[model samples]
Target: MIEIDTKKLVIGMYVARLDRPWLETSFLFQGFRIENNHQIEQLQTFCKTVKIDEEQSSPLVSFEAFKPSTGRLNGTPPPPTAAPQDQKARFYEDMAQAKSVYDNVSGSLNKVLTEFRLNNYIAIPEVKSCVQSVIGNIMHNPNALVLLSNLRSKHQHSAKHSVNTCIYATLFGRYLAFNPEQLATLSTAALLHDVGEIMLPKTIVDKKPDELSAEEIAQSQLHTQYGADMLRKITELPAEVAEVAHSHHERIDGNGYPRGLKETEITLMAKIIGIINEYERLTNNPNPKLQLSSSDALKAIYALRDSCFDAGLVEGLIKCLGIYPIGSVVLLNNGSTGIVIGMRQDNHLLPTVMIIRDPTGELRHPPKAINLDKFRDKEGKPILLISKVLEVNSVDDDLRDYILAELVTKNKPM
Candidate 1:
């Protein structure tokens, strides 16, 4: 019923969920059950020795392997996919347009970073308003969520961070069926989530991973307090906006920085912000050293459910967002590459995609959307199982041109 992090897992506790890699053919493990202290220790030792990095590792067993055993554990079965709901599932074109808009917005936000800082502790009203507007824009145009995922990058400065969080929070608010007013408010809070980072040293903010000392980590932790204080100075903003700004880093398990507040202590909006914040940070492949493939990122979060996130919320995000969240590059089963655009309520797995490039290095024809759910291969099988999800790209590939070229290639005389 309850999930615990693998690190803190105790023996004799009933297993809430069992995880194995999706790539494996079999899921049988002799010691998967932990009924007593000795069994727990053995499992812990086995996990530590062979577990790999939880954040980047794949489940060692497949869903098929674990399916038969779920009845014994009482864990909920994986829900049916959304793909079959539509009479004709077509998603590719919509996602492309969304991604195009997101790329432009992220470009503009990145341009403003020079005006912001982590140590100044100044809440620029203009910047805050800009962030608010961005959230509002996305809320009015729900399709914008596709672009938000792509906007996450290694640069952790306030401008980009605020926009990314706002997009995420707003999308989540929409999924929760909150009205426009509530969604706007959540977006504003997300936009200003990191306004406090201004007080820290630029050296610390931009520190190389290897260069950070214990003191730097402690100093970095103060940004939450600093951000809350900065937001309080804004007289016109809603009062609760500061909560998202303040608690975006606080975890459900009390393992996060600042106050180390647990689930009940953190606001519901703040909890949403925290989940999306970490998701963006980890999935964005922000640091050169920590880039994760889209598949790997999903796997990491799947393992983290309940322990690091709210189970219902996590499932909601996965359902609303789908396997390949926007901005992720995936290799389709038919030897083509595309970027995810958005989820189809009817079919989450076969989302609308923008075919940016082809295996022959050609762009799509007219850069139209391709609905994989309706796309079948020559063999009459679905031709779009995602092979990999692309995250951080140092160069901007002209996705529009790429998509068009792919179509051109497809129609060329054999």
Candidate 2:
């Protein structure tokens, strides 16, 4: 122990307790003048060994008496790595499985609808499993949007609507960053969102996209109520989930059908499905004679973002799908036309595209997927690319064949 110019003394180079407090609680060091009566008594008892002023001593003593417990710190924690390829493969596999389950449920629902059976569709174990699987796929795979874009009309209107709703609902859920559990619930709501349509007339239901009369539209809207009623029959169905399916048709501005709920009254999940449903329907080219490109469909939806769609959700859709989404052909500044392969995370505006043909006025075989990020000129300026929006089938090229070939750019995640 050593005393410095200051009133305090140190027990060791690092560890030091107050001299007075140390005397009362821990008697390890000694030899200091006590100013108070309390200190004098404490210090007297504490002083087993003593040392006065020592010239060679520092203020701190090297008393190695006590040791503190420590924790292990041998290695560092591992960071999460990017797994794009695995994610893409998993997405495809999950989507295929979802399609199978969706088809089965659709078939069963069709039979019920045709027979006019009032039995609860949700009560079926297989139907519930199908809904769960589809929802799970949406929650896990970001790129599953491509697989869910179904336009082919099967015999069952409710089934097709359910699949479409499920896809859009899941996409919207992903856009909102909904957790897996929330996504699954939202997916179930979407898939079964239009089960009530089964009750509608076959003539009105089978009405082509071009020939939808006012009565047909009104009758079609009834599906929302019909679906809700079916869901209500199932005692196990959660009220929140049922609400999503029932209220998906209701609008934010109080202009929607059925109850005509506005704003906060409309459940958030329903609102998401509503926006996505409308967008998908408007954009989908039901007429094989005049099909709209994916880009055109998106643009059409974007045009209605504020008035019809929830502003934030529309923005999220744009962010998720990218500006030039899949299935749209674009003419680059270099005079080459290519179909968009997939969206790039960093640059959503410029997605990875499959260059099918050069400006040489000759069609090329086996289109090549090129990353616009790497297509820069020598001066580091961005090259002229995708100056014009070319609708699918707008050009003379074989759009289907181009879509079938999946040659994506390096480092571009699915």
Best by TM-score: 2
What TM-score goes with each of the models?
0.63, 0.64
Cα lDDT, model 1, residue 118: 29
RMSD of 1: 17.4
| Prediction RMSDs, each to the true structure | 17.4, 20.1
Q: What tens-digit string does per-residue lDDT give for candidate 2 at 335-369? A: 88876655545566666676777888456664555
**lDDT for model 2:** 0.58
- lDDT of model 2, residue 70: 34
Off by over 4 Å in 1: 1-132, 139-141, 148-156, 208-210, 360-368, 376-414
lDDT of each: 0.59, 0.58
Model 2, TM vs. native:
0.64
Q: In candidate 1, what are the lDDT values of residues 209-296, reduced to their tens digit? A: 4578998888888888887887777677777788777887777888877788887888888888887887766655446557665556
Stretches > 4 Å off in candidate 2:
1-120, 131-141, 144-158, 288-292, 358-363, 392-398, 405-414
